[model samples]
Target: MFFSPLDQFEIKPLLILNNSYILSLSNYTIYFILVILIIYGYTIIFKNNKLSSNRYGVAIIALYDTILNLVVSQIGRQGGYYFPLIFSIFNIIVISNLLSMIPYSFALSAQLVAVISLSLALWIGNLIIGLYIHGFKFFALFVPSGTPLALVPVLVLIESLSYSSRAISLGLRLSANILSGHLLLLILGSLILSLISTSLIGFIGGIIPVIGVVAIVILEFGISIIQGYVFSILLSGYIKDSILLH
Candidate 1:
């Protein structure tokens, strides 16, 4: 297969599937498959007789690093219940984001389908879980429990708007960051390559941008993990508020 500065979009070698509707195998599909395999492998590992006593503990570690970061960062002692949904989003985004770090692998995080799906999944899942846990009282999230009735309607409308906006905010935050990082790397690589093709002076000029890109890459790498944590932590807070009527 051919390689490019932005080739992470290609289908991974492990998965084989036909696509009549789309031209290429979806990156998100492959990412989810990886997630499944990791979880499945962990399940088998923990099933060994010697390790069976720690299966519950091992299962948590197997899911997603993003989820663990979130629980540790936000929920503290209260993160247990939200692990499943949080883990799914965390694993998908982390895998998608990290894949783009490698040259020629598709950047699933840069695609709207992947990022938007993550945000929507979290938003809808939170709402459903909240309703299931708290019944109609989950709507109470819009109005703080102690507020006077005169303030209730406005509070509800404002909170509802905020709630509805979560999907876009969450998706855009991650997708935009990943997209910007990839574009910056591609532009720098192009400039350096072009400069080398031309003359020594151009080649020297390319070094400046290359250095800048390297620094930015390191910074962005840390930010990627931070952003993933932020998404999960916010979800945890939302769940806490929705369920606790806070």
Candidate 2:
């Protein structure tokens, strides 16, 4: 039986908690737990031991340093105060993306609902932080520096709209990238399967797409890492803007 390329994205219930409650165990829930466990394991492994001598430990330490530098550079010295949050976000995202690359594994990052919900929560949290720190002055974010009195209304409207769109855009960007990459892989794999199942000539023709599939998998791994970095950096920028009102 030929399954649809998108079938891999289906969220199947693994165990029903209560039929009436609409809460159940799913592949997503399983993978989500796996992500948390993986992060926790890494933290436990790298906790306070000398890492320079061990190759695996050194690599993990380097990753930590890289993330630390990223947060500090993007958000300034105060960024260290928020280092835990930034580090957690980066690790969770990158790990989840990497897990999705495993064959037959669910891609939590590709779920629009999950990504959008996370984006909205973080965006709202930033707003709350700004409001707590700056009070009414938080609204001043909608006004650019040195705006003429005449264009105040126009610029404020434009800025407000742009600012509000961040939640949608951030989540959409991650979901779109992962969804497209996986879709392409599924299509290519399906095509190769179909071709090889046919005559000898078709099997030979499938080699080209098989090569393309391999290339795309490598590209996808790089993109998965990059998307995590991009998400964290953008969040850092948002945090900085909220604190500095720039």
Candidate 3:
């Protein structure tokens, strides 16, 4: 049991080694493995030959269509080639966020380090993609059209800072949302426990918080989906900007 709401975020070592904790497994490793297995199972379902013959497969196809449309709309015909990458990103993140809501489960998306690392990698990958395709032309990204001569350097510096900040801000958006939502749920759960365990009057009033908890759970689920979609869209846009100068 957690003594405080923040206690749930504490990392606990799951495996002990011979006097050396430097490489021991932890809760994060276990949960990441679980998430990987879940993603692997989902890929198996996606690969089944008879997938299109069932309702689940139909839904899967619909989701694929949505993603395809998103990629094409944002990145154009070239974007179709990157569908696999975006699909993996969306799946891993959505699954991680959803599975974390399960009781006693570790929330990978809530971890700042993990989220920021992913964002930083994506940002770097985008840079590589841009430079690979356009070479020195990629530097044009920092320049704005119709800029006055005196303001060119100032605008370039400002643009560069804002562009680089996306790596941190993008991941922070998801991590902060997950952390805040989980904190809220924990607080409400504790409140309900205290209320129901109090006097008879408090027990009766506990129903209110129970309902609130249910509502918040539903809201969090919506947020999980929305965050996945938002991440995909923003990533697509970033990739688009990288690939296409100006």
> lDDT of each model, Cα atoms only?
0.70, 0.88, 0.87
TM-score of decoy 3: 0.92
Model 1 misplaced regions, further than 4 Å: 6-28, 35-73, 76-78, 145-151
lDDT per residue (tens digit) for residues 1-246 in model 1: 436665564445443447343545555566656756765665565446665357665554454454666675566666776677676666556655665676676677777776787678777877887799899988878787688899889888998998899867888888888888888778877777888779888877878878888898888777666766677777777777656656
List candidate 3 stretches off by more than 4 Å.
1-8
Candidate 2: global Cα-lDDT?
A: 0.88
TM-score of each: 0.74, 0.93, 0.92
Question: Which ranges of candidate 2 are over 4 A from the true structure?
Answer: 1-5, 17-23
- Which candidate do you rate higher for TM-score, 1 or 3? 3
lDDT of 2 by residue, 1-246 (tens): 114546447777877876843788887888889999999987887765676778888888888899899999998999998889989988899999999888877888999998999999999989998999999999999998888999999999999999999978888899899999999898889889999999999989889889889999999999999999999899999999899898
Give the Cα error of residue 180 in candidate 2, in Å: 0.6
Give Cα distance to truth, residue 156, candidate 2, Å. 0.6
lDDT of 2 at 246: 87
Better of 2 and 3 by TM-score: 2
Instruction: List the lowest-lDDT window of 10 residues for candidate 2.
Output: 1-10
Tell me the tens digit of each residue's lDDT in model 3 across 178-233.
Answer: 89999999888988999999999999999988998999999999898788888899
